[model samples]
Target: MTKALKASGFLGLAVMMAVGLHQFVILSGGSAVPPWMIGGHAHLGVLSILAIVMGFAVPALGVVGQLRTAVTGLFIAGQWGIPGIVWLGEGFGLTFLMPTGFLWGGALIASMLIMLYKTVTTEEAGGGGRAGVAPADD
Candidate 1:
């Protein structure tokens, strides 16, 4: 799962870079930036970073098995879905796709909240020890 997250993060970064270059080209030609491009670039860049960071943080949260799998899946889906939908909708003037993009954002938020809840409720969260951290030898 960690490797998968990392790979997705890198792929997202690549896509974000491409979008950025496209934005630059448009601006250089005296064309205004499209709303969809702006939104997609921002979401893609931020979510890509989150995915990379979460690759390490998720494992450290002590979540495992099916729960972890579900969380990771949500993260990946949201990461791509939000921006992809936006580009398809706004770029093509298909406003109906906006709701689906919001749904993806909601899924991403839900995954983050779940991880946060697990972290805060754990013994290691209080600084005791866990998630591969060695306890004091005392």
Candidate 2:
């Protein structure tokens, strides 16, 4: 289960990086991205993937509770683009931007909140500490 989710998460991050850099190409070149993301794309794609995976998976392993807490922070940080790309369009007269503003942003925030509340406050949260604590605390 965890492995599946991790794989999915990695794949999702990869796709996000690809799409993100592709936007830059589509912006500057004014052409559809071709065989692959290169030139500007290669540099940004790799860097984006590296940063996301490191930030996403570091705390999401072995300890589900910690992962939940970490994900909430990551989810929030990931929204630095929200207002500029999302809210600005929505605030005045651009309703077309509503999807990006509400759908994506809301999903990210909601999922993170659920994961955090479930893990951080659950009974099993502290039990994982019992194995090592009994010896060290005494």
Candidate 3:
């Protein structure tokens, strides 16, 4: 799962770089950049970083098995889906698809929330409520 997340993150960054170059070309050609393009580029960059960071954080938080798989899937989907939907809708004037992007964003948020909950609830080896740190001996 960690590998998948990191791969997705790198792929997203690659796509973002391409989009950024496209934006640069548009600017150099003296045309104003479209708002959607700028927004999509930002989303792609930020989500890519999130996916990469979450890859390292997940295991430390003790996410495993099916839950880890599900979170990873959600992360990948959102990492692509939100910006893809934006580009499809605004780039092609397919306004109907815009609302659906929220669903993808929601999935990403939910995945993070799940990880936060798991981290908070996870018991350390010394029975501490926090993760990653054992309680000091009395």
Candidate 4:
């Protein structure tokens, strides 16, 4: 759990820093900064927050295995690729990148919902409110 939290925290921080740097590029006219890029920028920022939140939630739910793997991959890819495709598109006029980015975004959203559902249900199974600790032996 600690490992997951640290990894997610670090990832979120990195994405946030990248977003900040990209903002400078946009403001300074280094990039053309298309309108859609604004959404991409926003998307990465929001995804970063989601990662951090999930980091905290994971321990409570005792989530592991395939679902964790899927969430981590999708979150990372979405965080990077979502904005990256937009950046690439704006830089080179490659409109094709948007579809791929959207797919990544969709996967991220689905994985997040899965995690949330698992966490909530796991908490219910464990008998209540908070859930960070492992459940007692039956």
TM-score-best of 2 and 3: 3
The better-scoring model by lDDT among 2 and 3 is 3
**Model 3 steric clash pairs:** none
lDDT of each: 0.88, 0.48, 0.91, 0.70
* TM-score for each of the candidates: 0.85, 0.35, 0.87, 0.67
Better of 1 and 3 by lDDT: 3
What TM-score does structure 1 among the candidates reach? Answer: 0.85
Candidates sorted by lDDT, best first: 3, 1, 4, 2
Error of 4 at 31 (Å): 10
lDDT per residue (tens digit) for residues 5-100 in model 1: 888998999999999999999999999999879999999999999999989988888878877897799999999999988898888888888889
Question: Would you give me the overall lDDT of model 2?
Answer: 0.48
Ranked by TM-score from best down, the candidates are 3, 1, 4, 2
Cα shift from native, residue 104, model 2 (Å): 2.1
For model 3, residues 20-80, the per-residue Cα lDDT tens digits are 9999999999999999999999999999998999999889889998889989998889999
Show model 2 residue runs off by greater than 4 Å.
1-4, 17-97, 124-138
List all candidate RMSDs to the true structure.
4.9, 10.0, 4.7, 7.0
Candidate 3: minimum summed lDDT over ten consecutive residues — where? 124-133
Please write out the lDDT profile of model 4 over residues 3-119, one tens digit for every residue: 654475577667667767877778898666567656666766676676677676666677678877777676667666777787687656897776796687787787778787886
Regions more than 4 Å wrong, model 1: 125-138
In candidate 3, how many Å is residue 128 off?
10
